[model samples]
Target: MCIVKKFYVADSHFGHERIIEMCARPFSSVDEMDETLIANWNAVVGDDDIVYHLGDFAMNLADEDRVRAIFNWLRGRKFLILGNHDYKRVNQLHPTLARLEWMATPTTSLETTDGGHRVYLSHYAHRTWPGQHKGAFHFYGHSHGNCPPIGRSRDVGVDLPDVAFRPRTFDELTKGMIE
Candidate 1:
């Protein structure tokens, strides 16, 4: 298994100009979009931090080598939870699996040491899982227009609120969930 860290960011959704324009908001051009993402990323993330790009990394890539190189330039470790837009050709360019760390699959589960559960990193929120309403948080991203549902339950982890989109600090993520 990879060396997991206490904090991570979900869904950078880099390199897709159309989706970035539509979903990220206020990005007049792709360059502006890249700048916004990079700035937000650098602000919250430190060199030792780990980030989880939970899908839709690149739709049309001219080169994967350049992509991995960019990841390196970003200055932190990355773990990708591949989304629908990721193609096999893009996977071939990376050194490891389709995603940087995690396998490129439709749905997977990640467990915190204390046993809280979260699901659906890269895709959109279609409909909330009825049974999961009282169980673990089900995180998805297909419906870019909607926000991930955060239901209340006794069993739910404490940090569930901050787990959604928008920038969050590493300390905020770990403090709420870990101890």
Candidate 2:
């Protein structure tokens, strides 16, 4: 039997160097930002897991081949959820990218396992969106300006000073937030 390992990936925003600086304005130096992002990704991701890229994988695909080649080198089964910036060029290499609208709020149920479904992946938070769905934890990245809101069953993955919060695991996410 094939055992499946699970992992979560999000907005890498690769290629643009000094993204921390560039986001303040625009890229200036020739430094390769994607390389650092890739390294950070590899540091956390394991070989036997899946990576879910939320969106904004890069500023532009001027170097599509190099970007895709690096992504292909990463360790994991990558699933791309199209974000606002994801254009046709980026999709060319990662053809399996999924439409964000199709994903159910709370979480997307891939298997028929008994317990509650976990980790709703999205590019942005849906404070109103998930409230309507049944109980399921959601994970999303976007609004880097805001911190991960502690909801009953939700975790935001954007790392910002004001929004800097501990990322929840599948179990913690599904179980709900602590009061």
Candidate 3:
């Protein structure tokens, strides 16, 4: 039997050079940022783990090949909720990025294996979502820690304030919110 761990993260911006300055990331360079992110992610996530990436996986990429390498470097079974940059921000999926197996385009929802808690995943924040009134949890990226989470929602973006720039468990993300 295998116990699969699940983690969530977003807005990694792997190939984006200016994101380090724009998001005030701690790294001095894009390579350092990417390497650190990859290292942090693999430190917690395992090959059999599942990772829910809310969006903005990469930016300013010359090609998807680099993104592919990042993907290969990380350890996990990855899923994506397309963010503006993940699909090139033109309101359409980039031709090159279309080849990756994101498992879903647009948005998706799932019930946690442990508690059967419903989690709504999206690239952009939502004022209201399906099952919102019924206590469904929402996870999203794109604000880079600007927008605060309302109710059971949270921003899992890499640049979220006070975060360690890595994938985190649902419990870790929602630690103080549940009470």
The candidate scoring highest on TM-score is 3
Better of 1 and 3 by lDDT: 3
Which 10-residue window in model 2 sums to the lowest lDDT?
105-114
**Model 1 clashing residue pairs (backbone):** 54-122, 123-140, 123-141, 123-142, 124-141, 124-142, 124-143
95: Cα error in model 3, Å = 2.6
For each candidate in turn, the TM-score is: 0.59, 0.63, 0.90
lDDT of 3: 0.79
As a whole number from 0 to 100, the lDDT of residue 172 in candidate 1 is 51
Ordered by TM-score, highest first, the candidates read: 3, 2, 1
lDDT: which candidate is best?
3
TM-score of 1: 0.59
lDDT of 3 by residue, 58-144 (tens): 876557788777878889888877777865546666655566665555343443432476778887788887787887788888899
Model 2 lDDT tens row, 1-179:
55445555445566555555744422355244455546656665666655565656555466666566766767666665556556555334333222222223213222222234534567666674443355545556666545446454243343433222222235433443432
Worst lDDT 10-window in candidate 3:
106-115
State candidate 2's TM-score. Answer: 0.63
RMSD, one per candidate, in order: 6.7, 6.4, 2.1
Full-model lDDT for every candidate: 0.46, 0.49, 0.79
